[model samples]
Target: MTDSVALWFRTYHTAPAPRLRLVCFPHAGGAPTAYWSWARELPEDIEVLSACYPGRQDRLGDPYAPSVHAMADEIAAALAVLAADGVPLALFGHSMGSVVAHEVTLRLGAEHGVRPVRLFVSGSEAPHRREREESAAADDADFLAELRQLGHSSLADMDPGLLELVLPSIRGDNGWD
Candidate 1:
């Protein structure tokens, strides 16, 4: 991989490379940049990489998938290539991303034949036991409340411009059941 690509997945806040890779998935409406600060808090022995889902960040030009399975499949394929080099890896995800992480981990194991060493899920319930099916596009008040409950201080603060930028992804992801 080129230096920039390598840095994108490997380096963390100018620290030494880690023996294990911790791939993170952000919540709905979240981006890879959200995890940048986490690099400093984690141990130097653990590498940190975050998922850059389509329709967000530099991938905004790409089409967004409408289902969790599709997202999981894509992630599995990418991680399959990464794992081929024999690097141990784990997963960490929050909120909607937790569902993506769980499904992607299964897809990785069954489809790609790669199992993560561990999985960390936060601010979300078990994927299999998820309650209700509320379309994100349908609910504005409740949806914003859910975002607040997920601990998105910035979303809770609700600056008009930021809200304009993030709401589309949130609404899109809500329909991703």
Candidate 2:
């Protein structure tokens, strides 16, 4: 039997005999598609599982997670169920996802007694090095400008049609409002 929540994952390719599973957590305003190609790019020994948070893309009908911690806790539970036999697990995160991955790692260890083979963080600062960036407090234009300064021009110039589809999930990811 297969896990239902695990089925929610998106992968660009599949490896029938993967040595390990590399679970990817996406950045803010990100979706499972962000790492979909990894399923093909990585070696056959690695199975890339890209998580899709709810209220975005095909999962739009599902309720959004209230906070990063809540999201992490939930995913950790799913991972525990999916883990079996000798299949090793690892995590990778980018931007806001780094924080989510870190929290999930902690939760898996504390609550489920599961430990990932490794935790890889990218495009984000360490917990002690983080500060509340002011852009979240800024108005729309200012926020876009701030994001532009951070080299996220896509956020500043995204098509209105796409923005309408993703903005709410982005706001949920950032815990805005």
Candidate 3:
């Protein structure tokens, strides 16, 4: 990937000549680091690349993506560069990332002439089944409650300052202002 495209991804393992590239997208409020361990678990021939959404982690200073389509556009462009040499790709995503991944997959095929070998998604409904009106909690209190209710109790226990810094990205990802 070029230096410009590199900003959007974090490669945990640098394969000498990867047989395949596995691109991973994280859930809302998540960072690329969430998939870091996959680098060690997967075979050396499968290089693991994780998407790093802006406004969090290393990209903390950057603006949050305006919309899922915007995220998909940028991600698709980057993946096109990565796949230009014909390295096969497989996409994996969870929750909100699944939607982004699905969009990226479509863009890759239609706009870039690249089709991923596989798309593995979990913790999200099929793209067509998603409700357009659904959104994140209305307020911080409700958001925290929702997180806990969704089995993200760890987030509820996070330091208040840290949580504050991460909430905007989470809310933005879910289509909230």
What are the Cα lDDT values of the candidates?
A: 0.77, 0.80, 0.88
Residue-wise C-alpha lDDT for candidate 1, range 66-108, written one tens digit per residue: 7988878777777887777687889999987798889989998
| CA RMSD, predictions in order | 3.5, 2.3, 1.8
Per-residue error for 134 in candidate 1, Å, reads 1.9
lDDT of 2 by residue, 1-177 (tens): 256555456766667877888989898888999997777778988988888888867888888888777778788888887775557889999998898889889998899888899999999999788886534544666655666787977776789888778777766666632
Candidate 3 lDDT, tens digit per residue, 1-177? Answer: 697568999999989999999999999989999999999999999999999998878899998898888889899999999898888999999998888899999999999999999999999999778777664568889977876887988886789998888888887787732
Cα error of candidate 2 at position 117, Å: 0.9
Clashing pairs in 1: none
TM values, all candidates: 0.81, 0.88, 0.92
Off by over 4 Å in 1: 2-17, 136-156
What is the Cα root-mean-square deviation between model 2 and the actual structure? 2.3
For residue 5, model 1's alpha carbon misses the true position, in angstroms, by: 8.6
Write down the lDDT that model 2 would get. 0.80
Q: Is candidate 2 or candidate 3 better by TM-score?
A: 3
Candidate 1: how large is its RMSD?
3.5
Give candidate 1's TM-score. 0.81
Better of 1 and 3 by TM-score: 3
